[model samples]
Every structure is written in structure tokens, then in C-alpha cells.
Target: MMHLTSRYLISLASFIVLTSMAVAKTNPACLKHLGGGYGDAECYHGLSADITADNDKLYRNLRATIPLGNAHQKLLNDYMASQNDAIKYCELQRNAGAQWKAEHDGSMFPALYEQCVYNIRKTQSTFLQDLLKMANWK
Candidate 1:
């Protein structure tokens, strides 16, 4: 009985490890280093930086359009120009990360925090891209 149980456990562990390795390869920048905090954090941070850079370019393109010639147009553009949406997203991610840490402890803190930050940055980038597209609709 003991031998059978040990073999079963070993098999389960191997299956889990193999599954995670497959997941990691699916997205090298974001998932490849997962299951370990430091490597995962590093990968996610780099992914976040890439997203942020893209967002900066999107913001610049959106800003350049600067819907002009009327008070309402200026108001709308100003709201988007101020980066309030991105700020709110970052704030939300920070709060969620803090809550996750409080509940889950530190072994996975880096992975969780970086992944959350990266996700929010990606969302922010998407929003900026959409806004730029909207601006170009004119």
C-alpha cells in the first residue's frame, strides 16, 4: 500500500510539473519563469515594461490629435490626455496586489504582484490604443 501511494504521488507531481512547463512555453515573457517567484517577477516586469513603452507611444499619438476647435472637444481630449484612466488602473492593481499578499504570504508575492501590474499595464495600453483609434476616426 505504501509503495503504491508513493508511486501515485510521484506520478502526480510529474504530471503537474510537465503541465506547468507547457504553460510556461506558451508565453515566454510572462509565463516561462512561473512557479518560482524571482524568475517569474523578472519576466513579468519585463513584459510590463514592454507594455508601458507601447502605451507611451499610443498616448503620444492620441495627444497629437488633440481634438480641437471647441470646448466639448477640448474637454473630452483633456480627460483622456490627463492619463486619469491609467492612474486609476494602476491604483486598482496595487490595491488588489496588497490584498493578495495579505492573504497568500510572500513565497509567491513577486509573481502575483508583477503579474497583476503587468496585466493592468497591458489593459492600459489597450485602452490608449483604442483612444488613439477613436481620435483617428475624425
Candidate 2:
């Protein structure tokens, strides 16, 4: 009885692990609609890194541009605003993904995923441009 129970436990654990992996690896149908694949994953990851770097550069540039009273204070305010906007954008993407999945099923899943990634990158670029402009302003 003890041996049987141990075997069952191991099997259950294995099953759970496999299920989790499948869930994680399976991209949402919307992602497919956007054209997401392994390449999309790579692109998104790289874009995320670039966004981080650009944000840092924006902060530095802002510091350089505004040497007036409490520059650091203004920087904090701007950074917080940008961060909040980014969080909101991510939430929008999550909701959009769910809606897309319900409407499209799994058809063209890769294309959808790619489009989602592209949208993210486009948003990031716009955000960075705005930040840079603010930093450059007099």
C-alpha cells in the first residue's frame, strides 16, 4: 500500500508539472492572431529591454535639461506618471487578449500574438519619443 501511494503521488506531481508547462507555453489565441511565435517572444523580450534602457536615458536627459528649482522633484513626478501609464497599457493588453481569444478562438493565433507584440513596441516607441521631447524642452 505504501509503495502504491508513493507511485501515485509521483504520477500526480508529474502530471501537474506537464500541465503547467503546457499552459505556460501555449500562447493565447489573440497572440496567434497577432502572429506570435518563438520569434515574437524574442522580439518582445528585446523590446522590453530597449524600453527599460530608453526610460533610463529619458530620466538622465530630463535631469540634464531641467536645472531649475527642484529638478529631482519634477523628475520624480514625470517618472511616476510614465510608470502609471505603462501599467495601464499592460492592463489594457491583458483585457484585449481575453476579448480577442473569445472572438477568434485559436485561428491565426500566431499572427494575433505578433500584432500584440508590435502594438506593445509601438507604444513603447511613442512613450520614449514623448519622454525625449520633454527632456529636450526648454
Candidate 3:
């Protein structure tokens, strides 16, 4: 009886651990955008692609080494300063899309928009952190 109880406890513990990991791994925000069905995957994929392209462009612009006069340099500086905020704005839009999907019973456009927003936030956060570290901003 003692051995059986111990085995049962271990199995229960393992199940709990696995369940927690699955939940943690899932992007609930992304799933929320998925809405009631599975058909929205394509929309999510497209939005993610779009945001990724935007992030790529921003990275290229930031990494450009072209020399500029004070005025142009100031423009670059301003852009760098506001880039994170812009990314956050995109994230908000994405969240709004997710919310719309949830409210509307899983519309594809909203689901895709939410995914785009989440991707933008994730990409922007990572990129901005790297950029700031390289520039010794923080």
C-alpha cells in the first residue's frame, strides 16, 4: 500500500508539472486571437510576416552607417528614441485585434491582427534591447 501510494503521488506530481508547462508555453494572447476555430492560422501567419518585415526594415535603418550632418543625425536620434514606443503602439493594435476576435466569435482579420500585434511587441522588445545595449543607452 505504501509503495502504491508513493507511485501515485509521483504520477500526480508529474502530471501537474506537465500541465503547468503546457499552459506556460502556450501564448494565451495568441490563442485568444485564434478565436473559436482553427481556420485563422493563415491570417496569423500573414500578420506575423508583415510585422517581421517591418522589424527587419527598422533594423536595417538603425544599422546603416551613412554619415549625416547634425540635422540628419538629430532625425536619426529622434527615430531611435521613438522606435520602441512605435512598436508598443503596434502591440496595442494587435491586442485590440485579439479582443475584437474574441468579441466577434473568432473573425480571421482580428485574429491575424492580434498575432501581428504580439509579434511586433516581441520583436520590438528584443530589437530595442539589443540596440540600446549596443548604443550604451542603459
Q: Write the per-residue lDDT of candidate 3 for residues 1-138, one digit (tens) a residue.
A: 999999999999999999886544333356445553444655455545555555666555655643555465566556655754564454455456666333555445444554555565566747755664665544
**Residues 1-138, candidate 1, lDDT per residue (tens digit)?**
999999999999999999986544224545744776677877887777767667778767776787556565566557555553554444445446667334545564666667777777777778777877877895
**TM-score, cand. 2:** 0.42
lDDT for model 2: 0.57
Give candidate 1's TM-score: 0.54
Winner by TM-score: 1
Stretches of model 3 off by over 4 angstroms after superposition: 1-4, 11-103, 136-138
lDDT to native, each model: 0.67, 0.57, 0.56
RMSD of 1: 13.7
lDDT of 2 by residue, 1-138 (tens): 999999999999999999886544333343344344555554454445555555567656655665568667576667656664654454345446567344444434433444455565557557667866876777
- Candidate ordering by TM-score (highest first): 1, 2, 3
- TM-score each candidate: 0.54, 0.42, 0.34
Worst 10 residues of 2 by lDDT: 25-34
